[model samples]
Target chain A: MVGIVGYGAYIPRYRIKVDQIAGVWGADVQSYRKGLLVEEKSVPAPDQDTITMAVEASKRAIKRAGIDPREIGAVYVGSESHPYAVKPSGTVLAEAIGACPEVHTADLEFACKAGTEGMYLAMSLVKAGEIKYGLAVGADTSQGAPGDPLEYTTAAGAAAFIFGHDKILAEVVETYSYTTDTPDFWRREYQYYPRHGGRFTGDPAYFKHIIGAGRGIMAKAAIKPEDIKYVIFHQPNGKFPLRVGELLGFKKEQIEPGLLVTYLGNTYSGSSPLGLTATFDIAKPGDLILIVSFGSGAGSDAFLFRMTERIEEVKDLAPKTRETLEGPKVYVDYGTYAKFRKKIRKANE
Target chain B: MPTPARYWREIPQRYRLEAGRCRRCGFIAFPPRLICPGCRSREFEIIKLAEEGRVISYTIIRVPPHQFVDQAPYAVGIVELDDGVKLMGQIVDCPFEELRTGLRVRIEFRKIMEEGEAGIIYYGYKFVPA
Candidate 1:
């Protein structure tokens, strides 16, 4: 019965249109927009990073969970862009949420699926009766090389899930992970941005693991695609999740609600978790949801969850993911975007 | 560079906005002190300050400090929290022209500054338009 008690999402209010970025490189704007199915992508402020966004998301989660901060026994943050390379991001998050001194904290890294790894760990800890509550957060201020194709999709966002057995919002049915030694994408030590294996990141890395984990979880849960009301997959681009869903026998309508990559772009570790939070904002009680996430190291974590009646009571406790996505966004040009992301070297440098 | 002790010591005031209220004369002090400035009272109570506040005054730093050189021409302000405590921090996520006396604002956790090229990052609270 250990499952999500509450969830929250944070999508930064700044957006840069595909046309805006394409204009800088003299690339075909129409082609990128059509190819990726993404109109614009979120950008984090210079001050905002993985730790700050994680704290904000975790705060909303605590509000929705309606639980004491002291009651949270563990805090796990998953991110590739942790502010400090040596310091643990989870400790800062836990202290910010007032869940300090007696909390187990860890900063995890597994590319796009890192957040779900935290979720899986939190659920396990809660189910084991060792902890009353655990908080799992996936957040990234993801970076891409200037003028690279990855810049168009790598974005900033965060999502948090509070796990507890009491007052469950989405009851966990089963979970599974499919992983292998596939180095489709990687950022080596001392590297500021990640490098990918170009087209190789597609079929062999993301698609294979996601499909394998998705089907494996459904089989383990003894359910078919038609039995699930909603589906969310790790969205490296807007097209991947839709195509993967159809490949797994899910209708477009079943995956559309959670397919937010068209707007927010790929938030790396926050990708699938943010989609799940958005789905939860609109899902009805008893609706079954299937979530599968792929990380490009590579691996996929799949989960089957059933919405609980308590969802309605707490869904509005924090800001909705859609509202943040559709809210008034301050659009920035390339120069400003570079300044905000600290891409341009200062005169002093 | 901010030492580990300095960052650790300021966590209560920086992270949680925990201030100190004097037992005598009811004076509040940010970055909580053992002796109240108002009455020199040794007795104090820890108080969590209100998140919402108003801008009392502001200054745009056109020539910035070392770590903030790239982010020059940014606005920093003195904010008066609803609890009557005032703290100085940067004003973010708003246009500089819009900054005025008594502008409604809310505090958010943000990176205050980085120490050096490869030093511990210092995070603190900043004011954003509410």
Candidate 2:
């Protein structure tokens, strides 16, 4: 059976406080920071594109895997935030990593869950024996308009996974998915920040969809929430998962590994898969991991992974996910974030 | 020098630096191509960019394209212009060591390189910290 051999994650350095937003808007800071539980969120620099983030993550994944580039046969990128819509991000990634040129490749997009969603695809392709090995990358440098609430939360980061029929750290035991025309959040064309149903998304959208998907998979696999050692959910903010997880009987211990979004912010497409990689960093051999992803167009994917004997073997990866969180920041004020997100027009600077 | 036809493929950038903003997806292309990469739409409006920004990240070209070998050791950075557009160019008019990650820079048309060995010049935009 094919499974994940190596994993890596990347989060950008910048952070913005909701209080800063509150400061600019002259809104009440006590309410924003206290309620949001966000001191800052990340932002990607101008030079740092999704391509580079994937490349950076791939470098770590490759190093962790210790696989020769020539041995790989495929590459897949899943993102809602690709740099060039047509120029395959997978192709650029292959070049960036010096992967063998003849690799079978393509890019994938399924909104925010695309990263882990791509992993499921790669697992299928690799298990089919159509390819000996493969790589899947999910990355996004999400944008938010100046002084907007998202400006304090929309962030940047990436994660990559190497799938092969080799020393498996985690084997794909069972998988499930729930998708619908759930457009709880969306950004219209040429808009910097996305439009959400607001409180509507909080109730029947995020909490309902994420828990429904997670609970559905647990039932399908005949596993209770107690059977899984950890749970990784797509995080858009600090409270959503905690609230939903509790309603579903999961404590902080079960979701701690996936709580990265509070520090890194919403990575859009990279959110859930990144949480999975972080869980892998501490997971013991023989542990079981349950993963779920939610995106606003809206959809969710659930997967159950069983850590194998190789789990510890692959643990010595460069810049552990926690260390990588200690970023190399490109701290920008509201104006720069606006320009980075391209919400404002310059007269001729 | 006139932009080569090959370069005009991204007209808003090569000619006018007009980024194509997706009416549906809200993505902007720097070397404004006709299609929006974000949502694959054809609708857009011209917006002038602020030619000033900061060096979010950059690298020194110890090894560069064949055309820029003479300018090795120069800094090339991605600057976030005031208009929310990010542009890439060499950082000129300052000591390379002084060019910090968040340095403020303004864009100006300058000679990037010349193909005609020692006698000709080619001009393009380069960043100078304001």
Off by over 4 Å in 1: A347-349, B23-26, B38-40
Best by DockQ: 1
The local distance difference test score of model 1 is: 0.91
All candidates: CA RMSD (Å):
1.7, 13.8
lDDT by residue (tens digit), candidate 2, A1-349: 8788888887755666565567777878776566666667777754456766787688778878888866778888888777654567776577546574679888887667788777878888898998877898889887665556666677788999899898788998888887778767787765546677767777767777788888888888888889889998888887877888888888899998778876788887788888888889889988999888887777788889999978787777556786677644445677666555556664532
The interface RMSD value for candidate 1 stands at 0.8
Best by TM-score: 1
lDDT per model, in order?
A: 0.91, 0.74
TM-score between model 1 and native: 0.96
lDDT of 1 by residue, B1-130 (tens): 4578989889988899888888888898887899988888899999889988999999999999878876788999999998888889999988887889999998888988877778877888999888
Let me know the DockQ for model 1: 0.72
| Residue-level lDDT tens digits of model 1 in A160-262 | 9999999899999999999999999999999888899999998999889999999899889889899999899999888888888989999999999999999
